[model samples]
Target chain A: MATTAGERESSLWVILLTFAVAMLFSVVSLPEFIPWQLGYLRPQWVELVLIYWIMALPHRVGIFSAWVLGLFVDVLTGSLLGQHGVAFIIVAYIASSLYQRLRMFAVWQQSLIIFVTIGISQLVNFWVENFVGLSQWDMRFLLSALVSAMLWPWVFLVLRHLRRLFNVS
Target chain B: MIGLTLLSIALMVVDHLSDLLDEVRSGLTVVVTPVYIVADYPNRAADLAQQMFTSRDGLQEQVISLEEQLLLMKVKTEKMSALTAENNRLRDLLGSAAKLQDNVLVAELVGVDPDPNKHEVVIDKGTQHDVFVGQPVLDAEGLMGQVIEVSPLTSRVLLISDQSHSVPVQVVRSNLRLIAQGTGVTRQLDLMHVQGTADIKQGDLLVSSGLGNRFPVGYPVGIVTQFKHNPSEPFAKATANPSAMLDRSRYVLLVFTEASLREPVIGAEG
Candidate 1:
């Protein structure tokens, strides 16, 4: 789609606002604020947000942004630096490369793809965490991937609505 | 992609092997602190509103109970003064230096580590408040953790239950010293290298030995909750529940003790 000068300028603002809100969601939805027993069920909000943006506007949200955002998440969570950065870059690359095909899929199929993408990211994270001896082999780490997959349809709809409202394209 | 992955690996290795990236992490933390403040706003607002709407009768009842507890504490402190003087005399007789009382600053928890595998928290106090890495922290009950990273306005605490953390502890009843390692589980620590014949028992109070100088001596660390001695094994496995409420504490005390003021030897704990 061709964009006018005004549309391009407004798209920049919309992108920034969406990313800021996503970061806010990642920070505010930490499991610490919830009951301790249910901490393992916390969804990967930042990952899901990255996936949605990359899928929607592959040309705009690319690998560099993913890497930087991952670093922000790492520092925010006080985890090993670069752990999330690598995972995010991989996820962003896959989403952008598959964006055309992804757009044609149903919401449920897209969620299944999200499950695979996030699961891959989680695996990368687990591998790095294991390399540094920071994490053990536990099946519970995959729970976030499952939860993120479950939430993908709603997230996709909300972001789609906001994108249309702002003429983000 | 490969180049970027390689760069990230290098960053991680550099971060783990030295203090080179600490300054970078602290600088980035300044940018991220606002996110945490914004995240905490709703909870803080609710607390404020709750306080404002509390009934006067309820406030009065709370004040009365607090005053009664204060009175009881004052009586106990009066007795403590006499015991302290006698203890000082005994130390002098033994030609040992008198223990200096530690000064403490109260700090509120600002953020908690989101990773379920890691037990850590950030506090409001930081380098500006004279908070240093390795400074011991405590809640009302017992030792909580030590500062691992300090930024300008905040610091990160590695809790005693973190997988990477270990503390030297001694049994109060038997005076047997052992190392307690964090099991990555809340309120639990594993005593490492304990012999099956060791005199540890259930409910034995474990206190910091102050041998490594990382933590101050005689602070309650935990109480033994389980001891298993398998005849086939060379060492007994024992676990203790930490005295501090690692999961529930909201405020903690930063202790400025004389020993902690000394420079911490790098890689000393290993």
Candidate 2:
């Protein structure tokens, strides 16, 4: 039984590591990595992970984690200080707020809502950057939102498998 | 918490007082570099493996041709160094560090800001590598913007073509200095505060004048694409395409120095 607990703990670490790696991958926007316009079609991998953890183990992923991740992103991306923090917090809040409703929705419906949430998050990112005086205002900004929406189903399935593996009852 | 906010505010004040923020940003950037490298490793390896497995004869031919081009460039660079030494000698007589060009660290762009209005990009190098804010960022061709923030291993560069960004530039052919501001269009720069009678024209090259002591002097900034002047209006409506390879850059150089700390006063127009 103690071994089983240890295994479970290790698995949890694995999950967190996977999430961090995924975030890093999503963050590194090499030109021509995606077939679309350069750096335009980045999927909101951070938002996907946020939604997954919120849906699977709502207790572990919370407002503070979301805020900190946002800060990391802000620091990494070099935007205004709190811009990603503001967006991530709002996205997590909305995801958690709609958690029960989201679980009941079909995969596509859930994905749509996720799309809108990530879209709004991107918009807020745009807003804060512009307000802090870094506005670009190009249509390519919509690319990430679209890509994130499309990837939602795959992310959902992956989270479901991880949940079962962990036996998150 | 409000306490955290107050603390951050205090840190901001202290940072301004003692320039401690650069140290903190540099430390954070160092820490993040490993994370970015670890994440990039697997994909990069897979790419290398794939390249080894399937490179073709045509590609090899192209590589040989590219090598020839590179050899030509090396010869040109040798000549450039001789001219640069002569130019430095002249500049020394004029009194100043010859406006040493910013020593730029070439960094792979990792990400773009997740918004349309915010034209920012994340580069792999950060403050740990000695990158500083106010340092100009550039793509292959021209000015992109400045280093706005830095993490331990990464830094963000604000592109000059973003709506909220602006830089001091001079018309190369006519020497008409003006502040070129971004309009969020990502395609053009709006030259601000120029009079209708200002000696400006289409196809003029804009270069950094190094007046603010922020960006190094003489980097190609943009080119005049269009001009609109109304007979009654005080200023001419002019736009220039930013010289930076804004839409196509995958790597950027962060220039981290100026010739002086004090702003250079405008010399009388020759």
Candidate 3:
């Protein structure tokens, strides 16, 4: 089980690549002029990616990295600074605590957890936005969670493959 | 975990309740800009591909039509010079403010606010380009918005159609002062505190009144599309279509007011 330095370095790079792709997707909306009702379809890409990494490597990608990632997201999205940081910290805390059970569950059941975790994260966003008087309808929170849950299986498979390919463990 | 979460909450509260995080946010914006620039490549590429694939005949037709439109606009503006001189003379008689032509810089819309709750766009121009906060932005049609945040390489614009945004406007026909509030819809604006007996009609024009001095005077704001009077409500209801294409325009002009122009030595930066 002698892992070379190159492999270890590559594992970090792979994780970064996933996060970068997620950030890119998080900021982009297809067609750019979508109506308000259709906005929930824009899945929380950064949160999804963070969930996968924390689940896969609970020791390596823990609360600190999640907070840093969330800070970047806050800047990228132009929200109140550290708003996403709060959400990501909470999600990371929950995901690491439940990582074993999450790994043991079926894909469908894993989505249920994702639904709750992402919903919790979106709740933080919703609450912060409301506090700042940038309120949207309540439907947006639930619909965004549903959409993120629906995308969980695909996101898990892809990240797992990348982890396996790069030996991220 | 608790410590970090507390830090996050503290950061949010401080950022929201005070200007303590403005400098921090601006510094971070410089770092995050590269990701947005990379993400925006697809849109720029799509535009280029469309231009590359367009038929030569189609481009020729477009150029011809644009030239004709330019000619028509030139004819319309030909009388503006005389009118401006007359207006200036009348203003001089009244001891009003001088209407010096504003220097404007062109900027391209680079990225949009990721949140659906806000109507904001990031433009390519920034403090590097002398794009300061509260600077007025415009398209060829009319006033679009004002700059709210300025970083070194980019600035954020709060569009006139945001629910939180409002512009002081006056009716063109009756010269009655009113306030136009954004309805969170790009095509509509609500005239607040309108009296039931107000003279606003379906086609009346609205212009910036320059009362707050955010937007310059006489720029078209919107054209009234609907008005209603209800005895139950305290104020009459009226809505107008925004003159600028809030959701459509890709390029906008950033205006440098006379007050801001006095700071930097004119020949120093240029």
Identify the leading candidate in terms of DockQ. 3
Q: What digit string (tens of lDDT, one per residue) describes model 3 on residues A1-169?
A: 8778888887898899899999998776446455754655788888899989888898789999999999989888778888999999988998999999999999999899999998999998898988888876666667788888899999999998888877887
Residue-pair clashes per candidate: 0, 14, 0
lDDT of each: 0.85, 0.72, 0.85
Off by over 4 Å in 2: A1-5, A30-43, A94-98, A112-127, A136-151, A166-169, B1-35, B38-111, B138-140, B185-187, B249-270
**lDDT by residue for model 2 (A1-169), tens:** 2346666676677566756776686655453345434456778887888888876666667667777777666555554445666777778888887888888999899888987898898898776555444444656677788888889899889878877776643
- What residue pairs clash in candidate 3, if any at all? none
lDDT of 2 by residue, B1-270 (tens): 344334434543454356556666566556556655665565477668878876598678889999999999889877877777788788989886754434556788656654444677767876567766677887778988887776666777888887767899999988889999987667789999888888888999999988877878888999999888898888889999988888578678766554434232322110
The docking quality of candidate 1, as DockQ, is: 0.55
- Residue B246 local lDDT, model 1: 89
- Candidate 3: where is the Cα deviation over 4 Å? A2-6, A32-36, B262-270
Q: What TM-score against the true fold does each predicted structure earn? A: 0.92, 0.75, 0.94
Give the runs in model 1 whose Cα sits over 4 Å from its true position. A1-10, A29-35, B92-100, B262-270
Candidate 3 lDDT over B26-118, as tens digits, reads 898898888878888888888899999999999999999999999997777767767777887898899987574566778898887766667
Q: Which run of 10 residues does model 3 chain B get worst, by summed lDDT?
A: B261-270
Query: How good is model 3 by TM-score?
Result: 0.94
TM-score attained by model 1: 0.92
